[model samples]
Target: MLCPCRGKLKLLVVSLSFVILFTWLYLLVGNSENGRSLLLSACLVESTEARLLERDVLASRVREVEEENRQIRLQLSQSQGLAAQPVEGNYGNQQWVASADTGPEDAENTAEERANHSECSRSPTAEKCELIHVACVCAGHNASRDVVTLVKSILFHRRNPLHFHFITDTVANQILSTLFQSWMVPSVQVSFYDADELKSEVSWIPNKHYSGIYGLMKLTLTKALPSNLSKVIVLDTDITFATDIAELWAIFRKFTGNQKQVIGLVENQSDWYLGNLWKNHKPWPALGRGFNTGVILLYLERLRRIGWEQMWRLTAERELMSMLSTSLADQDIFNAFIKQNPVLVHQLPCFWNVQLSDHTRSEQCYTEVSDLKVIHWNSPKKLRVKNKHVEFFRNLYLTFLEYDGNLLRRELFGCPSQASSESTVLQHALEELDEDDQCYDFRRERIMVHRVHLYFLQYEYTPTDDGTDITLVAQLSMDRLQMLEAICKHWEGPISLALYMSDAEAQQFLRYAQASEVLKNRKNVGYHIVYKEGQFYPVNLVRNVALRNVNTPYVFLTDVDFLPMYGLYDYLRKSIVQLDMASTKKALVVPAFETLRYRLSFPKSKAELLSMLDMGTLYTFRYHVWTKGHAPTNYAKWRTATTPYKVEWEADFEPYVVVRRDCPEYDHRFVGFGWNKVSHIMELDAQEYDFIVLPNAFMIHMPHAPSFDISKFRSSPSYRYCLTTLKDEFHQDLSRKYGSAALKYLTAQRNI
Candidate 1:
């Protein structure tokens, strides 16, 4: 048993057991403080597997973005190429023929004075060429005609020597050159550039609405023009000049070198890009904002030195092109580049580029018949039948076209035959407009509610065959049950009341209903109380629920505080009976009036309310009148002469509209206060269901002290949150279902 090998093995086993036991004891004690902290540190660092997974996800995203970028670049590249050079038209090269005997020699002093004007001299570059360089793009025959008209307007207003740089096709270039040469004014020098020369450079730019190749011509102004020009004003073909070219040229002095405002432009004015582009993309510096490129002031040398073309190429390479949501081609490209470099642009006032989409005209540009410096007909030009504003601008454009060649004749002599003809045409157009004044009047006719007695009201009262078949729906709190009680007492015939309330209020109202004689045992009256716990007046939803509960064909949507005037029920019953099923499809809207707030007793009848109104004891608030509620354009006249008028698309709160259940139901999206019941009104309007406002019958709105706790709901967080959600949803839903018709009404209200 005492062999050498066996003794050695036994020693080794005992040594290993001792080592394992010691190691276990050390780990157990270390786990309390420093060891525990070390363990947490290890856990905090991501595991190898987790780290790998995260890296993989990030790599995938990069690849996706890269792929999208590559696709857009490919698209942009594919569109680049030179358009074929245009062929010359039938009009061959025609030499300059003087239409006026008076030459530049005769007006040399005047020309020199205008060229040396302070406005031109004050600019950084005062190289006197006696030229006001104005650049425009005219690619087609129609565009060439517009350019002629524009040039005439420019020349007629300014005595200063003018140089027109026209970017056009071969035919337009030839035609326009010939037309300008005929002007025979030595102060005017007309030059032309075939856009095809620059086509290879901007071939990558695709068409987007009006921003196609023609739109992109100004972007490449530096390379397309002679290097001697210091600054140039680029204009759209659709625009007409209202002020002199010299005034527009004066803006060059404001573009300082320190500011590095290489381009001067005005904001787009309309929220088109702001809503579509800016909202989707993150905003940049204060100066980096949306602008309309229709009118621009280009410092030619600065743009060339900046290597704008190279910067544009860099933008494409960086894959910034993918950020665009179509309809914003060149505009998006320009903005993206400017956003990266904010100092390159100077924001001009909105007047410089007066867009047709703008709701109002320029106050600055309103001098005599031509106050605005530039009129940009970007929109409202598509319609043949235009509003008065559009008509005026249209006539102005036509007048310029009519007097395109007459300006030279007038400069030599007195007012020529052409001038008289233009006046005649304008006078005729204006007279036609004068005859159609009512058609052009956009002012909303005000609604007036005059107090009148029951005898003044038109009452065709015959008892209904089915006695009291209408159901009245109201949402109420326990405190306002007395008003409901009053309505029940005064309203004749049978009307089932569907009251929406909270659980606690419902319990209290049920008790009151049991105690009251009018509500307790009357078989004709039904108290249908709907209760929800913790509900903060879901106005439309409650109305919808109540609407479903209604058993009768006709439903009256009213508030608890509404006390119907004398003979209302009788008149309503007879009116409902007289109408056929086809006529009953439309709602019967009875206008409601409010009594004095401090008055304890409600007006017993319309007669009493009228008497109080005349005696100056009670005043009708502004809200009591039956307005063209949330309408874009007023359709029907005010109901001064009419007893009842059908409104296709308007409704008010506590509207007293008796509609069939099948009509467009209340939109449940609307919540408290502001947009409360307007959704239902708009929906009914969109569905072509007319709401007839009844002057014959009305209801009294019994007033109380301003309830701060309740009225303040409009500004409350809950109300605002709900309102934002509902408003967006309402517009989207209507727009999706009914297109622009629904959108028109939804935007008209702007209830949110």
Candidate 2:
């Protein structure tokens, strides 16, 4: 009843009185706490909130009671689809995402009494228990990396795994089946969401690891819930917890006078501390807001009655709702709601729901061990940045939240204030997967790369001198040291080189590469060393290396083994010279590659191969390639083709020019044959960087040594074994990476 009408101070008391009366009426009508709160909101009143309060109160009470009873019957039969199923516009009682206007101070939005909402209420029954909802975002054993431990901990702490949830794709079957066979828990219901089944289909949310056709699945899960459920707790698989959420829920309930308030942590406003992204591609008031949507509790039936799901369909269709983008989709949408509808938003402390840390990622773990509620481990590589933030929170929970887990946590599902027997949301995401011929989750790019310019380098040697073209080519071809020089010479922006070392000299290289003037006025280059033993140094070492070198907003990585296809950037250029444009919205330009012509090794025996002189000169890399595939003809032939900065296929490159630094990027895993290059490319991990061959980009590979190392190529049994082992490992990794692509290219076309 305490409706603080901030807009017009004149009607404060009048609105308050009406709110009180409305609350009374809602109580008699058996309106849910959320329903009563919303019903009393003057924000939704268009014409006369006062008038409606005077007349509709008592009358609506009787109508609501009758509706409540009817809905209770439907609630009891939800499993039979009697209550969950929708009639026409929607086939299931779905929760539509709402889109409100930017009204007063973003804290208050213009709300109209929903006219299309199908009204429903429920009556309590003898059987009452807690229900938690979970979203199995991915099926491939959770790309987040902490899946097993997180899940196991939840099951151990909360005895009710069946009460958990599985909002995911079918491949999740691997884990879902494991859980099913392992436990005999009850109430484990699964709702396979087929996006194709929904009338409203464009996704308002994006599932990066899961199938793209999952928006409808969200609706399906919402539809599957029992009509009798008063509240639904939404959770992502990455989270873990220490606090008994019931207490948090209770707190949420207390602050929410007449409604069930949603609870969650707030995201940082600073762009740098936000999700992986810095900003959105499309220009608009940021979509999702400050809420860390990983956890939230909402009134299930109340949201369903308002047709929130349908609204989400409409909003997603018109607006961009992808949470993965610098937090554009899910997080952004939640942010929007809290900002626009402050009346419905229930702000919680940052402690409970924790996300991976950003700039502060290196800070402590467990926040004072006071009052912790949940935990989320994002990614292994990112753990250093994210895990400690959780620890910071966990520490706080253990210390101040006043929870005596020795006694509280001992009570099964009971932590601080909730009941026993443990409570975990059931996971059934494995049952829903999309296997269409085309991949909607990713957008494949088709590029045109042209062969640029090339010429014999100033230095040359003939095979007769051991200045022998065979040995010379073997050295120059495999040496990527020149890559740093080329990129620096041609590129006029930030250039990153993945070198093999990060020592004193390496630090000096970055200092110049990232200098403001060098990165701006001249050539901006940021070099990243590919450390053979990365652990010896801290990650901050690399970050500092980058910070000291390049000052440009954007940086490009170029491998030393690669060379610019002559005029590679000008293939599609309308003129010999043109204005350069920089942007994150699109690839500014793609690079065309070609190999630097080098001498070839033609040795016929292992003795002769290793016996050849100039281990420091012409044979600079010295036995790097001979270590893999030690066959007579092929090893000799393959060794001739080996290069340190080698790329497997066209897909393994980023658009770039030339640069040089004293970096040795010889990766053991990526060494030997063409195995290591794949690791380097995969390490980049940008979804957009997937190869798109540019018609103008083409490389004239300087053939490898054909005759110098012949002797070493043969009779090296141990070397052959190493080659075979590496090949097997490479193939397995390739298969894992390119799945279908590997099937289509590796074995299918034997003669290519």
Candidate 3:
């Protein structure tokens, strides 16, 4: 073995020596291409790993953004519930409202993070408390109007320190900034934000028309809202506050013990999920279930911990984007995720989001409307119709705008105090209006008035044969000449214009009537100008005068501001001709719409008016009283749909009426704003007359900004005298007629 090892060692040494010599030679003179190839291989291997790492980092960032979007949307959809419901709290007393801070900014706040939020408001002192962040997504003029009204309600009720986060576009930001700067709430700090900052986070989110892009902003709230703000309350634009919102903020305390419940919101009190549309949607709960996000309360700290990112992952996996309904949009997506994780939700009271959509549903859930803390007008009808609820809320909302304006004027120009009188504020507003007039004045208002004037005043009214099917009668002053012109121009048949004007106004109208080509040329039109000597215009008496002037077999009594729906005359002519004039005492009640924008030409058809309504160019005025069986039927049921639906008259409504014979004469008693027209409707209802709502025969009320001087009418001595006389006359008429049985029909609100 040793001999063989020695021989092998000698051979191995020789071989190793030769190998070393060859390796040295190869290293010294290797092929250049082979060396380059070996170096390239090493670089490619390292580069491939770097590329993979970079791709992963980019992908992770994208995923994070998507997750952020999901979270923000979830927060937004639920935030509306925040202020929708509030408990009676320490700040519920009127003392808090009185002690509320009225300054531009809160300077004494030292609130820490979400962990120490409760400590931030250790005292009732409004200044030293940390401002709770409240976010709302508002865009465009209408939405901005809503936000202004909403914030006004919030600040008006909340004496607690708060900051308003207005998520809006650049233009909306400027508008909201200017509007909020006027509010003198030191406890309130307003910050405007653009979704553009977080838009990239939701880049993968769908941009559908049903929900729009603003709805997506709520999805990024976890990252978008200031990190310093550990909690937030979100509200819808349509919400009205009736209680202290600080009580709403305190609700976060209820969520403290629960790990899964990060959102507190009101349930959909209406039959939102009751229809078959949601039957197949397994994610949807039982009928009359689910929540309305009109108002939501979010615990930001807890929301951050929740795996909201799973929304995106599941959405992708289930292909829900393509499967979901556009009508529900983000709301549907949120419901889908939360349905499986009910523990994450905090069910609030139905009164929180008092659904003012369907009365049946609203009654079923939120029975006590007066007890409701937040009124959520959830009906799409709210967008177009100024019903009783809308009217009440709208006026209340306008009060806030008026307050904001007055405060702004006071703070900026050092104007006189607004606490003086209504007239004083009116004067200040008038002065401001004058100042606005002096700027690069784009008189959209003046242009609109002029357009209406030209359309109504100049449209030629040609007489028709058959003595005009129905006489269109109206009572007016020279102030309503534009309206008269529109009615005269639009009414296809005979018209009766009964003017209750001053001597000067009568002369003014006489001059125009004699010179006007349209009015002067019409043969079938009748003009009765009765000059009035007093300041008070007896609206009912004047209407009676107009009604008495009707010469045709059938008469349609309406206001000067009302014009028949296009082609209504021909439809009425045909329909009335077919009726048994001797026996049929049918009273036709037609739907009325308020024109939202200035139109140079009248709507040619009801379809045209409806199209404008859908386009947001027109809106429906308050006909709420009509829906409570106060009228024959709720025209809203098919107001824009089918035609010629018969409805039994239950109670009287307004001046809108059509009668041939046997109908009671105008009361000639009720006076002032709204007057007592319902009494006449009651008389007709008692007579057992047939009521029909003509879908095709509608009226379009022209928009007008009546002078603020209309308010002065109530205080006028002449008006008071007229009211007394009318009240006495109404009492005598009721006593002489059906006794107190018809007393309920009187305009009791006026106590006349």
Candidate 4:
């Protein structure tokens, strides 16, 4: 207070110091808050990463468990002895498991059974289940039948797995493929190689054999077959095995230590190789009596190692200089090769191949017919060969011919016992027959003929989600396949097509269908191939094939030539529901009509169809020519009825119907054109199935050239005679099978 200027300076300095202290305190608090936020953010990021890793691990485990469940389910199904239903979405590589029975008492045994089942269920190339490979060259329907007989004999006796490699033409391939596919034998697999692909290899060798160039296909086997095939047993279509083929397969072990031994063959049992069968028999050169090529065990690995192709070609070229052409084709060339390279052949016992050709001295090979391991009908006349023991061998062939191929699909464990029982039955049957009585007489006047159905390109269509679909079942030849697109489009539901054609036609049809815009993309059609085998058209057999394979609850049985009116498929579905058809034994008849004009626009509605009928452009199917065929439909009543109307069955009535899938099958015995459809209707009547005519549904038969059967019926007296005989026998059979019901129908027919 005494000095004013000094006091003021001191007070200002004190105020500046107080302001700096407060600012330092505020900066320290802000730094602490930022450090806490950084620590919290780091913890959250670490925690999130840990949860993500845990989720990934759980997802992986779930996937693994799912896979294990699938495997366990498959194994369990097999263990329960359930029918191996094909796994969906795996059509390219179908796997089938062998059935097994496991007991609760023995856990160890159960484990062993599981392991064995797993082994059996593995792919065809699995190591534990060694496959015995057999190859054959077969073409045409006749050849296909012969091959079936041959395979039947093998299946009847095989103890191990079998894989058949067939060199076949388009027809035989289709037939064999169809038959084998339907067979579904668990222990067997089949593969078909087109014979046309191999023709160029053997075509140049001039062959005068009765079988033509097809016989020469054997020479190309070394190149035709898979390179990985180490060994194979090649058999002729005409051969029948009397014992297990495994015994024949055992011959391959004999080739061991002998590097040159490439083939196991039986010596020829005839004097033809000795050049003594005829006065001017200039046979190909042979070592002694030569060797038969009918039953050959080829060491494919050894043959390839020795360059078999070059060797056979050289041999053929050398032999061709001396001879103009090979009379025996494959047999001649094979014998010539073996003659030059004798060390390459291991001679199989004569009983292994008891040849039954006309000139055969086969009695010297076997003491009795029972001693025969493989019977070879190496003659054009086949069963009528001039052998002294023709009846015994012929009967043996017939036994296999009449064998039910379905039996071959029985479980592997049951095969040996079943085969033994069958053999015993056959022996007893043969003993009871007279020596002069043929087991099967080709000339017998029989109504029913043994025909195979669904011989190729078999497919099963998936049902719609609602399961209220109708399957259109029909039969046709290749020429009629042109109508398939229209039929399929109009139906718009699943179509079960039974195609009857030769092998060449099948190939053509497959190619055409594949290239077609409509046919290729359609998955709703099931094309069941029935090979046109016999002279007369197997119309009923084809119909049955299409009829039997339908997966839907209802089926519309019609011919391929007949086009259903628009909305027929939808109408049938609605009618079935409205009429409660699933619970009834009634057939919904679709009235059929025909037109003489080759190219008429198909009517889309029933009114339009009736208009066409009124204009004389269309008439009831077989109206003037065979009124009896459609008269039972009662068309006059059908036109007036708003709802379905009942019609009394009449003789020779053959109206198309939409019936339950379980309806009486078309009698397959009434083959060809005339009586096929009528017999089916007669059986339906015998079974007491009600014939109800649908008011709206109709079928229009498109005019085409007459079928071969119709043409033959018009031209040949023998054909008509056969038809008459077949009809009589059919009537007798129907009377016997259906008893009083059939007799009543027959009485009504006679009165008519």
Candidate 5:
């Protein structure tokens, strides 16, 4: 509607406005991009500076640590010089000039020497000499004997000092601790790590191996061992060393200059990883023949630095997604990791770990049996494996089995008189064993190295002039541990307990005792663990262990189920003095009784027990079933006599007694349920020890189910026949040991 000139002006204005708006938008977008770029660059620069500062700080700290270590090494060298002078006896051995004796200076030097010696001895980080570190995982009772044999072999050939690291359960730790503590080997040290602490790390991984989670514990050594320990030699319990472990330790040198090699392992001797052992065998992924984990040289520091925990965990997780469960546990995981990262493993000579499995092809590894350095009994059948050379290997294993651990304490050098003589004897014995085919029948009766784990938990026994200072020596299986608290509370004296159980039961019992209010706090109780070796319960063996550990002058030898009368400890104290027991070979019998009820009010005095007896509430222990067991106590005379009454020993007499600490040890051959206690009484009688019945002292046997051996004796004809044969053999042994006169107390048709 406007004129032509006005419309042209409006169109021009509109175009100008559009151009300005577009230019403004371009400027705003360009500025935003530039700001973002500048901000990112600033951030990058700041991050780089922070990282550089952190690196510099770390370098400074490392330098500080290195300087400190150098200073420590310098000080240690000076201290060693001071310590060596007095030990060498050089100054005393040499004739010194009189002027060399500067009195005050000499005193100061001696004081400094003593100070350095004390510091070196007490310092945790002091390294006076090189120590070969060995790691082992022993989890159960079955492994106790095998591990002992392994340790024996290691000590037998070790020329240098050793420091053993044991990853163990409570039971195995207890057993190993007792053995090593008693050995007291100079320049040897041992440390224990609880296997339970590392269980969670590998417990989630499904394993079908017979060893359960224990088999996987080795996988966690890098995490379980101390951060200070950099290298270790891991061994299975069933291995025996033929040569010095120093030879095996030297293999670590081959891994040097090879950063990728962190673990040294012997190749698997069998075709286990070939996936051709059986039909449909889908073994885990592995290199040709894989490698054995039984003997591993672990570079712990390198492993940790390279994140070995994460690597193995990830590998296990990925493989588990495809497989149902691992067949060989940690060994499978190890092989799988090596297959993927072959550079991480350094293969050792097969002679180092000569696996002796049923399907073993390890014979090709060694030209002669002497070439084998380490023997691994990888099969469940042990010495009974199908190998043609089983006898030779069996003999070698038996040599360690029969080895005396005490001989290991002999000094290696310096003491020429005794140490050299004993060392020669040991060397000659070993040489003779090596020269002969010393393999004997596996079934032949022989002496075992029993009394292994003595006083796993010990009470310091302090003797008193009072007669109350008595120790109750008792034997029981783990299930019977429930009676411990009641007896300990009532007796008020020291107690030595011999527990016969498998490794698992011993662990369970330790846990149970820790949770117990009375037992955990008890300071007068000793626990000795006896591993269940054979099918039969070693009842006499358990008794001997308990008796041997009693430190009190008087020991009341009794069973765990029997609870002594109140004031019995005090009564025995007074009775010992009154009866002048110190000068006499006498055993004071504490007549034992039993009740049918599961729970009853225990008698506080002999009067109350007699009342219970007259009221038909209690009967003498095994009175109705086996009269001879307690008939020798002479209960009829005990009822009226205020003083002790002499009782003649009879066959099958087994009465609980308060005897001197030097009482005869029980016959270990009388195992299982029958004649174990009776044999002890027979031996006591043969030794001319008098049995006197205590009128006031008594013990009450609580009702419980019969033991497995007792049930077997009642149910199995073969068991009864074996017991009868053992009894006959025992009589013959007794006759041979004591004389024909020792058999005069035996009565024909006697109940046994």
Candidate 6:
């Protein structure tokens, strides 16, 4: 009954379907195993070629490394003025300048060093003189200057007649030198070398801090000091001084002619930093030695007799050849001299050269030794510390004092005052810090900790076999509870801490609300645990929970991921009370944050890619460096310099942050974590909490949020991770050091 056309159409449809079915079958039938095996075979053949290429690359790398070693050996030979020795070199060319230049950590402006830096009078009423002859060094954003200042403060502030012989590369300074010179009937003889005098002789690439820089300054100081002068304290500019300068002078005076030599303080008794320059490649630091350059009390007579100045100058000159390869400068000469017993060495009080923003503040507070002579602000946060208003003002004023008459006559008294209307406007932005800020004695004063603490929030989400989001909630709860216990047990002050735990876990961790006596007797550790069961908890809820919990006099909300170092208790106890802002009493007390297992190197194959990733944007998701927590509070625009979000910037774990108690506890208006942040924190009491973040203790994250690859962490205490040569512990003689406590602990943890 069907028409001929309809029958044909049906037949065509069936035939097309059959063809498609047969083709699919053909594809499925051939490769089932055999086709795959063939493809894999071809892949293996191609991979063999790849392996060959990799081998060639590796062989090329080995040759390149060998060449680099040759160059380094050559330079070291030239420095020592010896025939090139092939006894395998360690600090090859590229690692030469790897030494950090940010200066000493918690570097104090001691009265001793301050006495020599006479331009700035600490207090008008305070007696500012001590009879210490000189302590000199050149510092370009380093801890060495801090050490100098600390010694100066102790020596001079108490009215002891002290002359801090500062030989700076910066020749023209007015505020620190001339301004203060105008104020006092005092003598702080600052002998700043004319940069122009050596400009022609200096190489294209000038040496950074501590690079034969010390050696050059030493030479200059030797010439400047009187020939009869018995001694000189040659600090590298990073030490802190808490004790009187007279004590150190006494130590020098007590030493008989038979005893006095070049005295350098040593911190690490062992062959420390063995692989730092060599990167665990081999035969490093073993080629030389290690010692702390914080303070070096030199017997100038011995120095002159030994031609120490010549030694430093020659070494500095040789360092110029292989500039890119070396990380350390004058430190190397110090090591070589010390090794030969050319100078006497002494171990000073640990606190005198204490690394500022250290973790062990609590333990350090009780150690009864000389007051901190120099605070070495040596950690990574030197720039941040320098950015402080107090430090900035003081440094700016000092720079002006140290300003050369020529530059000032041209800039200040000449045509335009740098402190102009535009500059005044820039002051609020911290854009022109050098223009307006006044100089002061930043070290002699101790920072005080208030009653409020800002505890940050953290979460780790890992779905189980059941695919429930609740796993994260449990971890957050347990960690928060642990933090509470730790605070209750260790924290000495009455603090109100706010926490922002996200409800990423579907499981309700709040069930254990009263499990731990979070604050114990303390009233301020606020309990604002935010948990959203199935969905991402609204950022509003996260903040609100913290806001409602703060009932104490002050409040700060921070993350739970931070593990405080030993000194945190004291740092908080002391630094918090120093804040001049009103929020010091009611605003956020943001503590410092540092990451554990931080490494600078990445996979070569993925270098550009990782760079693209790490250089990602904060709020703009397109750029790869954007971490989850970098977004604005209300998802507002970024690049607002004065905003709280921008103000909160630091290299450490900012996500695990802190906030003030009086600031809006929670901005519930925003649905998620980052919204309404800048306006709320900065705009609300912009002047107060805006600058609340302080560089105190280094809070280490044991198992931090946004976890990283664990396998990559060092299996040993090798400093090779940061070095260029991939050297393990440098000294070949240190066979037993491999089994040290630190290495053992690392191994145990890796096994765990």
lDDT of 5: 0.75
lDDT of 2 at 235: 62
For 361-443, candidate 5 gives per-residue lDDT tens digits of 77655557876789999999988887767898999997887666656664544322322333355445554442333221111
User: Could you tell me which 10 consecutive residues in candidate 6 have the lowest summed lDDT?
Assistant: 441-450
Q: Whole-model lDDT, candidate 1?
A: 0.55
Q: Give the TM-score of candidate 5.
A: 0.48
Model 1, C-alpha of 84: deviation from truth (Å) = 52
Clashing pairs in 4: 170-503, 171-503, 178-455, 178-456
Residue-wise C-alpha lDDT for candidate 1, range 440-476, written one tens digit per residue: 2111100111110010101123334574366666655
Model 3 spans > 4 angstroms off? 1-130, 207-209, 274-288, 310-326, 358-360, 383-752
Between prediction 3 and prediction 4, which has the larger lDDT?
4
Q: Could you arrange the candidates by lDDT from highest to lowest?
A: 5, 4, 3, 1, 6, 2
Can you tell me which runs of candidate 5 are displaced by over 4 Å? 1-129, 414-556, 559-589, 592-752
Regions of candidate 1 where Cα sits further than 4 Å from its true position: 1-130, 257-259, 276-289, 316-320, 324-329, 358-371, 380-388, 409-752
TM-score each candidate.
0.36, 0.33, 0.38, 0.47, 0.48, 0.30
Model 6: per-residue Cα lDDT over 608-629, one tens digit each: 3234335541112212343433
**Pairs with backbone N, CA or C atoms under 3 Å apart (clashes), candidate 1:** 79-203, 80-203, 80-204, 365-371, 365-372, 367-371
- Candidate 3 lDDT over 1-752, as tens digits, reads 01122233344445545545655544543347766566666557677778568657856765665565565444432222221222211111101111145331111111111111222212123232435678887765457655655765776666556678888876467556643442333445678778778767655655453447676667667777776677888887888787767666766765654556777776565445555435564433421356677788877777777656565347433544555332454455555555665667765555566667653244444323454567776667763443445565555545554343222222212222223243344345445544443211211111110000001111224434664368787777766787755676677677776676543454467568768777767656655544343334556565665566455778787778877875677777776765554467788776666665667466687767667777866666544333332334464675455757676543335537777834687664454453356667766765656777766766777767663335654456654555555555555666567765655545443442
Error of 5 at 550 (Å): 12
Tell me each candidate's RMSD, in Å, in order.
Answer: 33.5, 24.2, 30.7, 33.0, 29.1, 36.5
Best model number under lDDT: 5
Each candidate's number of clashing pairs is 6, 135, 18, 4, 2, 137
lDDT of 5 at 656: 89
- lDDT, candidate 2, equals 0.36
lDDT of 2 by residue, 1-112 (tens): 2212222333434444565566576566445776556656553565676656755776676576566555544433331221222111110122222334443323111111
Off by over 4 Å in 4: 1-131, 134-178, 181-460, 465-467
Residue lDDT tens for model 4, 252-313: 76566366788888778788888988798878888778889999989999999999999999
